[model samples]
Target: MDVRVLGRGPAEPFLGAQDLFETEYDLSMPVRVRIRRDPDERTWTGHYPDHHVLNISAQAATSAMARELALHEYAHMRRNEEAHPSHTQSTAEALYLALAGRRVERRKLTHCYQIANHMKDIYADDITLSVAPADKLVAFLEASLATALADRPHDPPRWQRLTPAADPDITAVNAAFALALCERHDLLTPDHRLYDLAHAAADDAPGVSIERFKHRFKTLVDDPDESEYRKALVDVTHQYAVETGQAAD
Candidate 1:
């Protein structure tokens, strides 16, 4: 698949700072940027495996805000690259902090965030952790991948630091979190549609894009007893796939 940026309008002149970042930033790949007066997504950037930004769009954000959001997204790409001595920003996390990113910051360390940080630790200890156990206490860092994938199909305005796109495989981790959260509390109605959708997405014949698949999967968590609706939706999704040429290939 290819990511093509839709440049529907006149390209906005590159502001001085963005121009500078475009020329001087440590981007691993070239990113196409387009500013819009009104975008369905407040601020979003898509990237292909080519490491290029397929599209970066924002609807009239101040230069400072755009700069910060760009830096924030950049951190997601350069996340694993350790900083050299010449580089001041060591980890992507550090770079985010340096840029004053993150919508929420705990004055003290948080148990939820810490637990997510220690997911590897729990595995290392060889202790069997219950799936429903850590519903609300997973670390932000650990759950980061899930949150990223979740936002791709529905990139809302506010999910910063937690809304970068991720690979489809990461959805399982989030699915686990959803189930665990529901088990701990009955927030989900029994007729939820997502349970079946998740199974369908995991099935050999996933009939939609990963983001769409996940959106459908989340439908269950929102309604637990909607089995008939879920069935009809599945059939509709399959029929739509056939009509749209997805099923042919």
Candidate 2:
């Protein structure tokens, strides 16, 4: 897959890996990866960002987990992390409102607002949120494509490598958005990304223990006995169900 330098601005050389990469690796930003010492050469260490990087240590990565990570990082890079995040209440929202100009619609905005809140909760521990509904994200993609097509009709995204989300910089926004949406869907089903990844590996470390995973997840939300986590989870689930037309309560 050709590394698509996010359509926001002028394309430049890709980043990372001096010895291994002959050419630039088109990686988007907010990139996250785990670094490991190469088994063959402990003197040299290998860096594996989410999964866009072609050079990966097979022994280091567990199947497609690395790939998923790279993709996730790439999506973060491409999506609304730069000038505009996917969801910001004040000026940012107004900006998207101006550009999309009532085209954005209330549902998307509200949904994205919820998306922001989730991100806030997720990153509350430490990571931090730059901007969710980043203006650069939507603006860049929309403007880029609008300009690109204005000259001559181009292709309709060759292989869905990454999606064009709102905001600026990178090209993985769509992937991130879709993935987040899927995760939200799954979680309302109350599944964690870890569980999904573990099951995908199917390593058979032990018997399938969904209950064990749930217990672990309950800790993750900071003691389900605590009112805030429980209430938030309940509200998020209810909202999802109501929106998706699967509302039981």
Quick one: best TM-score, which candidate?
1
Write candidate 1's Cα lDDT for 1-249 as tens digits: 111234553232223223433443345555555555555655544545554452344453443334344433443333223221211222233223322322222311122222232221222111112211222233332344334444444333232335344423334334444444343344445655445434433442233244443333333332223343334233323333342232223
Score candidate 2 by lDDT: 0.31
TM-score per candidate, chains pooled: 0.25, 0.21
Model 2 spans with C-alpha error above 4 angstroms: 1-34, 37-60, 80-82, 86-117, 120-180, 183-249
| Candidate that scores best on lDDT | 1
lDDT of 2 at 80: 30
Task: List candidate 1 segments past 4 Å from native.
Answer: 1-25, 34-38, 54-58, 61-64, 80-249
lDDT digits (tens) for residues 18-136 of candidate 2: 11121322334223232333534121112234323223333423432333333333433332332123212243443343233233334434444443444433322111112122222
